[model samples]
Target: MPDDEPALAAQRQHWERTFAARAGMFGSDASAPARAAALAFREAGLRTVLELGGGQGRDSVFLAASGFEVHALDYAQAGVAAIQRAAEAAGVARRLTAAQHDVREPLPAADGAFDACYAHMLFCMALTTRELLALSREVLRVLRPGGLCVYTVRNTSDPDFGRGVHRGEALYENQGFIVHFFDRAKVERLAAGYELLGVEEFEEGALPRRLFRVTLRMPLR
Candidate 1:
């Protein structure tokens, strides 16, 4: 992709077509980690939230239904539109707002605009660590002081599973997108400002089919 080009539009189109073709795969329930993170915030007294890179607004819809006022951002137009439609259909449209925004740029919202923010499977797909750190800083910029930011990234130390596997040191590219790999230590260093609340790893299938999963939280100071 060129420097001025926005890859998100293509990405959004790809997912939109996929979801439309297989709506059954786009389950109404939130992902395991997203649900766990949201429940954690609820237990900690957070009702207002922001979701960055909230593709198709699955988690945003769920959070809004659970009584959270959600501002969901995605660079893909289709993804944002899908979220809007879904929110309307779910009758929580008033609780949710979806917009097209890039994480690489400064967020339009004011400082301390949200009590919490959540992202799922977003960071790992970046082409570089700098991109990931830039996105992380943007998340920190929009969050309230001492608020929480929760998200997941692939673990690097896991055996080379067939999923997202690359031939060499070059980052993995799928459908013209790049995904950077990281282990726990690198992620901790990248998210230095936030306290590392937790880290977990898991495998999906046997070696060549396994995926390493890590979840962590950072507190905005």
Candidate 2:
């Protein structure tokens, strides 16, 4: 955390190992947020989606099946492979592509390459505020004007908040996984140049992680 490259490397390694050891660790269910995002993206008349942090590809398969061309990225190689396999299994491989990427770096897409962007829980990873800001800008750059972006993040109100090893900058470590928790102010901060269309509170998992489902739109200018 704290924008330290060494720490980020460690975090990436941890995730890589975890994903390698636990294929489909998150199971094959498309998250509730992803399901809702599909409808919202469809309603917005979106055709292409760039999905970040597509762990195991459940959302990738589902979105492709829902008729959206999806390009999914994951930091872990295993996760990216999982997505490809899931896409093939679901017979949506033609509509879905998977790649390994780290969001802290520049996105591997041209400006205005995608009609929409989606992320299930990528913003809450072991990322610093500065890194999150840069990532938001990258997401902005990759989207077409008026394109929508739907993402979810674990919020400060979550039950596990402040319960683990403090990693500075509102980040805490639990079970060897670091998470950068967001508050409403932080969410608004990242919405900088975009229109913050919606922020809805929701819960997920057995711990019932409290999160905010956020939607943003780029200006048509």
Q: What's each prediction's TM-score? A: 0.80, 0.97
Error of 2 at 56 (Å): 0.6
| Each prediction's number of clashing residue pairs | 1, 0
lDDT digits (tens) for residues 1-221 of candidate 1: 23222443355466556655654344667866677777878987887788877777778898899888999988767778888988999999999999988777788788778888877766665435566677777777777877777776656654432235352332454555545556666677767777667676654333432233343444544
Per-residue accuracy of model 2 over 1-221 as CA lDDT, tens digit each: 34444565688789889888998898888889989999999998999999999998889999999999999999988899889999989999999999999999999999999999999889999888888999999999999999999999999999989987888788888898888899999999999999999999999989989999999999899
Clashes of 2: 0
| CA displacement after TM-score superposition, residue 161 of candidate 2 (Å) | 0.9
- Candidate 2 — worst ten consecutive residues by lDDT sum? 1-10
- Decoy 1 TM-score against native: 0.80
Model 2 CA deviation exceeding 4 Å by range: 1-5
Best by lDDT: 2
Q: What is the C-alpha lDDT of each candidate?
A: 0.68, 0.92
Error of 1 at 62 (Å): 0.8
- Model 1 residue runs over 4 Å out of place are 1-25, 157-170, 175-177, 203-221
Candidate 2 Cα deviation (angstroms), residue 146: 0.9
